[model samples]
Target chain A: MPSLFFTRLRQGQRTLPFPDAGPDLPERFRGLPIIDQSLCPSGCDACVEACPTDAIASDDSLAIDLGRCLFCSECSNACPQGAIQFSRQYQLAASRRADLVLKTGQSLQLAHRLADDLHRILGRSLKLRQVSAGGCNGCEADINVLNTVVFDLGRFGIQFVASPRHADGLLVTGPVTRNMSLALEKTYAAVPHPKIVIAVGACAIAGGPFREHPEVLNGAGAILAVDLFIPGCPPHPITILDGLLRLIGKIASPAAAHGEAP
Target chain B: MTISLPSFHNGEPISLASVPLLSIREFREEIIAAAGAGATLTALFGTPAESGRVRLFSVLGDPVAGGLAALSAEVDDAYPCLTVECPQAHWFEREIAEQWRIEPQGHPWLKPIRFQAPYRPPGRTWARLPGVTDFFAVRGPEVHEVAVGPVHAGIIEPGHFRFQCHGERVFHLEISLGYQHRGIEPALVGGPGKRTIHMIETLSGDTSIGHATAYCEAMEGLGGVAVPARAQALRAVALELERLANHTGDLAALAGDVGYLPTAAYCGRIRGDFLNLTAAICGSRFGRGMVRPGGVLFDVDPRLAADLTRRLDNALKDLEDAGRLMWDAPSVQARFQDTGAITAETCAALGLVGPAARACGVERDIRQDFPSGFFRFAQIPISRWSTGDVFARAWVRWLEIQRSGVFVREQLASLPHGAIQTPVGAPRPDHLVVVLTEGWRGAIAHVAITDPNGRFARYKVIDPSFRNWIGLAIAMREQQISDFPLCNKSFNLSYCGHDL
Candidate 1:
């Protein structure tokens, strides 16, 4: 018991004061991608052609759908002109699906505080029920990580409850597979009214890598009315936390959200 | 004359012509004979052949020799079931039936593993939607059934569990999954396209490094690309880091399940620390983009290497302190020791791999048995425990955690110097490659057969969860129903990995 106490003491205060001061993201960590179309030669479509998920518009002046991007850096690697680069911008949550598609000079419209009534109800203490439809468990893993000591998601009063009945909204992951479509719908139905839905990760936002696969329904937005979208192969835990906090008005500066990297 | 199956080393490509195509009877005998001689059934899948016939390929892995024997037989409608004699072929056969719309005539339990439309529907649809089917039931007046869900009570993937129980004791446990299936296998039958690596990386998200490495190995083999030594070392380092993170998380979850908060809380944070180390090397915590076809995408410079080594040492120390608390606590031991015990014989019969089998005293590890990539040059000793219980599983993981920690440190300290990646070309035509990676959970096997046009004719992925899910079910037999969660965590099988 004494050793346990000592271990706890040694581990000491791990929870980051995130939002107050952003956590230090690794230099190599690929977050919000920056595309400078001006550098692209008129005939050269290297990034567009090299894009795996068709994330980059083929008939384009360089616009990338972050929802469809796996952030594998193949596009960047294939771009001979160094027109595209992934900046270490971890805050990439958007209020609408349209905001996830970033053009050369456009910034993402970060998720806004929930509708006045919903914010008033869930602003302080929002309980979410997570449904992993056809997810690979990547998003789920990071979501679970938020509850760990470092993130301490509970500190923000955002707890993941067991039952949908007890939840105020749904936090969804994965490209909604036909097999899981019914279960996701049922879980959403079980949640009380005034419920908001958040699509987390690339799959949940726009099917990620499995887009247009016959087995998937593209994403949660295909079936449910999604209020928020966090885009990543599996969005980093900090990205997820930032999304939740902003949606609930716990952290409310949309100006400081996208395109900024430390 | 004795019929010999074409054998190849791990990650080595074999021409489709070189593989012997035996008669159905011969193929069946070869499979059963190999199983009898202690060969693990690595993969058994079907591909659409000429004349509307379905060609079935069976891969038998000989762990002792570190070689794989492969043979094929064409089945038009239905053939003799291999599961009757070889229990390990049970899931693979059902998968074939569901995917190719061919039946395993006499499989004791035949059902769609993933409830999706067949890839090649032989004039009809045999597949049903998820959870709309029958489960093996135990009939008795005192027997009451408990069904737990596709949508569970945790922040986990979806799968259903039906426990045929009397009071708290269970008669039998049946697990039906498919909720996470996204037709990844069927969707992969093409050249190494843009979306291929991304799909493989997410095949089993937690085992991203494992599955991705397997796919990359297969591609490297088919494309005849020589990976640089430095990239190999970094990949192995990343792999061990993945193993460290997952095994630590499992131990923490096991502790959390037993209501031991101190260790759980500490290890949980330490798990993130390990994940952060992986993220340090590659952008993603799950090691998604770190591993490419020819080699790794990210390089650990000298300064970064030293920094990672220091961070790893600190995290390992924290894990050791946290783990000690759980092992020393009597309450935690009482809950973990004998609960959900499965015998070594059961483990072998069910073809369990990784720590689950190691916990049962089965000395099988892909790194040690069928070494590939960095594993060929560097080796981690196989960790084992004979108890075959929750405690043994946890202990095996802890032992592995320490060994993997040491391995990662060594690799990081003395990384080989070279280019990070080599240009990989299209896969060679009419070749087949099987790659086995020892994921944190278990062996992740990927088999790719290419077409004449240098595209994928068929792609098969067998996650460790597919082999060990039944092991979890069998472990729950006769145990207290309350211990299901603990037992479930002990195995920690992937639903999507299986469903896919």
Candidate 2:
């Protein structure tokens, strides 16, 4: 018992104070992609060609889809003109599907707060059920990490319940494979009415890398109404937490509606 | 007498014509003979052949001799079952039957492994619904059956498990999976297209570094691309870090299953700490977008490398404390001691790999037995235990965690300096290569065959989960039904990797 106490003392206050002041991310971490269309060489489609998931547009404007993006740094690496760079902002979630698309000038459309009636019922204490239809476990791991002592998602009154019937919403991951399509439908149906849905990761949002495969139905959006879209190959845990916080009104919505105040 | 076949090393590309195409009887005889002599059946898959016939290919690994052997046979509609003589081929035969619309005549359990359309058109489809099939049952008034998942209660991937029980004791456990198939192998048939690496990276997300390394090695073998020393070193570092993270997480999970909260809570965070070290090297926590065909994409500067070593040391310090608490607790020990014991003989008979097999003292590790890439230069000794229970599994992981931590620190301390990547060209036509990596779970094998035009003719991935899930089932025999969660976590096999 003495040793246990000593060990606990050594561990000492590990949780981070986040949403107030963010932690320091690694310089190499690729969170959000910033596209400078003016620097694009004439008739050059290097970024588009280099994108494995075709997240970049072929048009002259160089629009990129954050939902489809794996955030692989392939675009940044392939661009000789240095038109594309990945910023260190891990807050990339949105309310609508089209809001995830980043054009050259516009800022990302962040997720809006829940409806007033629903917010009154669930804003303080929200319970969710996670369904991994075709996930590679990347998104699932990060979601699971939120329950750890460091993230301590329970502290925010957000918990992942065991039963869909007990949940206020469903957080779905993966590309929604054909084999799992039925089960996913049944799971979403089991949740209580007025339930919200959040699509996590590139696979759940826009099918990620397995988009055109015949076996996959692209993503969760094909069959369900997603209230929020969290984008990444598997979005970082903070990104997911940020999305959930914004959706439930735990974090205040930002003032800027578009590009970083020109 | 032993059978003679064309043999090669890990990641070595050999001509398709070199593997002797024997008759079905000869192929069966060769595999049985090899199994009797203690060679492991590493991979068994089927490719399309002429006149609507399916060509069955087998890769056997001689762990003792450090060599891999290959042979093939063409079968029309059905072939004699090899599972009766060699139980390891049971799952492989079922997979072949489902994928090629061929039957393994007289096999004990013939069911659709993955309920999906066959690779070739005009082939009849099996039961298309996943987990909608007859399960083996035990009948009596007192006997009851328990069914769980496809949608489990926890935040996890989908798969169904049925336990036939009499009161508290479980008679049998049947695991039905394939709810996560994305047709990854079939999608790779055209070329090494843009989406290939991404698919390989997610083949099983936890083993991203492991699978990515195997695919890259196979591609390099086919294209004859020479990866620089620095790139190979970095790949090894990432692979070991993956091992450290997963092993720690698994240890945490095992503790949680027994209702031990302290170790569970601490090790859970430490697992993330190891993942953060991986993120420090590249960007993603899971090591995605780091490995490529010819070499790695990210380079570790000296300062970053030093920082990683320091942080890794700090995490290891915390892990040691958590591990000690778990081991010292009597309640944890009582639950884990002899709950799910499988014999070493059963392990070899089933061809189990990774820490599950190592827990049985089998010494079947890809790195030690089939050293490729950086493993050829530096080595981590295989950690094993003899009891083959949940305790042994957890103990083996702890031993591995310490060893792998040491390996990462050493690699980071003296990283070889060179270019991170080199250009790799198109693959050679009519060539076949088999690559194996010792992933955190177990041995991961990828077999790639190129066509006349240098396009992928057949690409087969055999995840260790394919072989180990049955091990988890067998370990639960006669154990308390409630111990299912503990046993399942101890093995922690991948459903998507197996389904793919």
Candidate 3:
């Protein structure tokens, strides 16, 4: 055992490149939301009611505030929207909230019929800033791992930055407890325009199951227009990798919605 | 002739019947005898008595029903020490000495356990004086102390570990906790459907399920409410997921700490996957909201059921391969081996629980001994070893992970179908309920009373970290400075959990 100690001392810094090496993530991992208009229920707007961020709105048909939807999968479960299928493709880089929206009532008919769309990047790096609104620390744990050698997001032109001023993406976690509300809003406001807001935990999504409380803040959508919602109380690192890859346009489909998130 | 004191005036002992009162010296000897005979000392409950000092309520044995015992000791102003016999009484004695100034006589080690800032307000009667270890404070080769945290880099909880080290090797370690105390014990008096459960939920963010489970059991025990078998099975499944989530994350962290990148990342990913499954099943990645007082708050739908049963199968398999690589990986093994080795003797003396105890070869699991609800109907295996080192601990966690994954699968396959929760019946008053749970970290024992209004009269939670902190200090006995993180994580006792 003593001899074994000398040999084992130098095993640090072996990195597994994610995003750049771009490991093939699964289709079932909860990613963003896509609307299935046919399955959209009528007049039952529990999804809208359940949405903590007011990410979903209904007028005979539910319209997912793609920018607001936390992909917490709450709407997917409550939607007259069996309409919300968790999209498997992870690369969802968008400059506007409209890009994240899902229309449940045949609104995407022509858009769906169109050929595959590919957008060009301007060669700018994607910088991410994480703000924990009110998570139980699971998502933060996953985010920390993303910087590790295994899922080093830096390999994919995506970087985790220290400040909102340098970030193009926002990784907001937690269920938005009452105390974290001001900080959450201030953080979103600090990030410049053309930046995408990605709510990572179920707390930031549809407030997850902790929504049973009046004290819990719901998701970050109540404060800003969210671009991508990664459902799961704390999403898988690969699921996170999948989400990051999708934001960079490397993946063509978003992963499935969190089982219950809309 | 009976001597009646002012403090005891008319106060009744902790037990009226089924327990006989023993004089101070005789009681202390009986306790030592019982503890020496392998009767686990469950707790030492202290209450102000007629003796003008606090009386010790020593709960003894691993008997199916708890053993009740009490002893009355006169408060002594001189020679405040009692650790010579009952080693377990060291902390409790010091606590009593500091709080009420009653010294435990003839104790070998006497140190301050609480009231760190010292009794202030220019001192009052029965208050400990401004005291410091002047003997160790002197200059001759006095080990330079390195005070690390109540705040540290990284995301773990807060604890102040004072290291007495000579150069790179550690000589002594003193850990000061409770800085992050949120007064969870006092807050448990909130009425039913009150904010108390939620307060309990936040006691230890990671051990939410364990705390809530223990709370529910205490409620169940007091109310005599029989939860449906479906709820029992669901609780078991949730527990498995909770255990898997924490163990996997901790494993990944240990591998990462040892600088095994692939193993760390892979295990990290698997951890996320398992948490994803937890989120899928119960919505909260940590399974927090899933547990309520009467039963679970929600159910696992078919879609999640499929993902948990199928998709997770692959993740678990991949995780096993990753864990295998991590385990067999020579560097990871050496990184942990003997890094933070606690002696088996210390483990037995302290009566620690969970992986820390298991790593040190003292086998105890509340799930196995004091099974409640689902565990009463389940087979929760206890894995242990005698290496008393970090490597042994990490190995124990990994093995437990395998069993945990299997447990989830087994519970899911045999899941009884029904509503996740039933309407909680009104709590009854005047009942004392005690419930114990083996959390992701260790055993969490909850003791509470139903007030006349069916609300909590007094609720007390004893997290395993309280006992395991002793092991942590013992592990640092002769280790080097750099191995602090290894030792800390090996025990990984929660500061928030214990402080609460």
Candidate 4:
């Protein structure tokens, strides 16, 4: 017991002081993409052809939808003119799906806080029921890390409950498959009234890589009205925390936090 | 008469015509005889042949000889099952029957393995829901049944477990999966296009490097591309890092299951530290987009390599401390030592791979048996424990963690200098290739058969989970029902990996 105590003492406080300050993200970490239309050569669609998922739309102006983007940077690598670039900005959550789309030279906007009523109802604490519906366990594993000592998502009073009855909202992962659609719906219904659904990862938001497969229902949006969308192949734990904190009105919008715009 | 099966080396492409086509009777006889003579059946699947017939392929691995044999037989919808003689062929036979809609005549306990439609031309479907199959039931006054999951309490993939128990003691446990199946194999049939590598990386998301390496090796084999020694060393480093992270996480999860908090807390952080090292190398923590066909996408520069080595050393030190704390704890040892014990005989019979087999003293590691890529140059000693219990599994993981740490450090310090990426040509037409990668869990095998156009005609992936899930179920026999989580974590099999 004494040795165990000493070990714990050596480990020290492991949680990140996030929302107060951002994580020290790696330089190579792919996040919000920047598109430069000026750099794109005439009659070039290399990035469009290279994108596994059709996250890039190059008909007129270059635009990327974070909802479908896997952050693989294949498009960036494929572009000869260097038209597309992925920045290390990790805060890519959005309240509305349309907000996830970034046009040429546009930066990713932070997710909007919940309505005043929601803040009154769930501002202090949020209980989430995570349902992994056909997820490849990547998203599930990252979400699990939220509770670990490093991320310590519980410090924010956001807890993942075992039962849907106890949850205030449903945190759905995976590319909701046919076999899990029924269970996902049942889980959503089990959550009480005024329940919010937050879709985590590329799979939960837009089916990510398995997008057009016949077996998957695409994502959580096909079944439920998602209140917030967090994007990544599997969003990093910090990304998830940022999204959750923003949704619960725990953090200000990136624009407001920077004291620039509404 | 002794049957001669066409042999091929791992990561080498062979013409499909070279694999001898046997009659159904001969195929069954040969496979059964091979099993009797101590060969492990690696993979068995069927592809559509001419005139509504199916070409069934069987892969057998001989650990002693360090060789792999492949043979095929054409069957017209019905064939004699080999499971009657070879118990290891049970699940593989069921999978063939389910996917091809072929009837393995007179096979016992035949059922759908993935509960999906056939990929063949006719597409005769099985009209039943997933997890709604006939379960082996035990009935008596004291005997009761317990069904768990498809939706588990914790964060996990979906699978159904039905245990027949008598007063808290489990008699038999049947695991029914397929809830996580997304038809990934069918998605990979056409070509090695843009999405193929991404699909392979997520074949089992936790095993990103393992499956990705296997898929790349298969592609490179067909393309006849030799990966540079530097790229091979980089891949080995990433693969070992993946193993280290997962094994550390599993050890922590096992401690968590038994309520040993110190090891659980520290190891979780240590596991994340290892993942961060991978991320430092290739952006993503899971090593996504790091491994590409012909070579890896990212290169570990000298500075990053040094950083990785330093972090790895620190993490290894911390992991050793936590592991010592847990192993020395009497409570943890008491919970893990005898619970969920599977004998070496049972492990070999089930053809279990990875740590589960090694824990049973089976000595079956793909890295050793069929050396490919970096393994051919540098071999890490196989770590094995004889107990075949939860403790043995955890102990094996600790030993592996130490070895993998040493390997990663050594490779990082001496990283060969060269270009990381090489251009790969089109796959050879009408060829069959099998690539085996020892994933963190076990052996991940990918078999790709190309058409006349050099497109993938049939791609088969056999995750180690497919072979080890049964081992978990069998291990639960005569154990306490509540120890299920501990046993399940000790094995730590992948659901989607198995389902696909």
Model 2 agreement with the true structure over B1-500: per-residue lDDT tens digits: 24677679999999999998999999999999999999999889899997678899999899998999999999987998999999999999999888887888889999887787887677555768899889999999899999999999888999999999999999999999999999898889987888899999997998999999999999999999888999999999999999999999999999999999889999999999999888988888999988988788889998888899899999999999999999999999999999899999999999999999999999989999998989999999999999999999999999999999999999999999889899988999999999999999999999999999988999889899999999999999999999999999999999989987
Per-candidate Cα RMSD to the true structure, in Å, reads: 1.7, 1.2, 9.8, 1.8
Model 1 residue B295 lDDT score: 92
* Alpha carbon RMSD to native, model 3: 9.8
- Model 4 RMSD to the real structure? 1.8
- Residue pairs with clashing backbones, model 1: none
Per-residue C-alpha lDDT of model 3 across residues A63-177, encoded as one tens digit per residue: 6654344344555656554766666544433333354455553221101111123224312367777776545555667677777565666767777776677766577776564
Model 4 over residues B34-151: C-alpha lDDT tens digits? 9988998989999989767899999888888888989989997788888878889989988988888888988998878778877765655575477888899999999999998788
Worst 10 residues of 1 chain B by lDDT: B121-130
Evaluation by lDDT, superior candidate among 1 and 2: 2
Q: Model 3: residues >4 Å from true position, as ranges?
A: A1-262, B1-30, B45-58, B61-84, B92-142, B301-304, B417-419
CAPRI classification of candidate 2: high
Task: Quantify all predictions' global Cα lDDT against the true fold.
Answer: 0.89, 0.91, 0.62, 0.89
What TM-score, over all chains together, does every model reach? Answer: 0.98, 0.99, 0.67, 0.98
Off by over 4 Å in 4: A254-262, B121-125
Model 1 regions lying over 4 Å from their true place: A58-60, A255-262, B122-127
- Model 4, residue A135: C-alpha shift (Å): 1.0
In model 4, the clashing pairs are: none
**Tens-digit lDDT track of model 1 for B317-422:** 8888889989999999999999899899989988999999999999999999999988889999999999999999999999999999999999988899889999
Q: Model 2, clash count?
A: 1
TM-score, structure 4 vs. true: 0.98
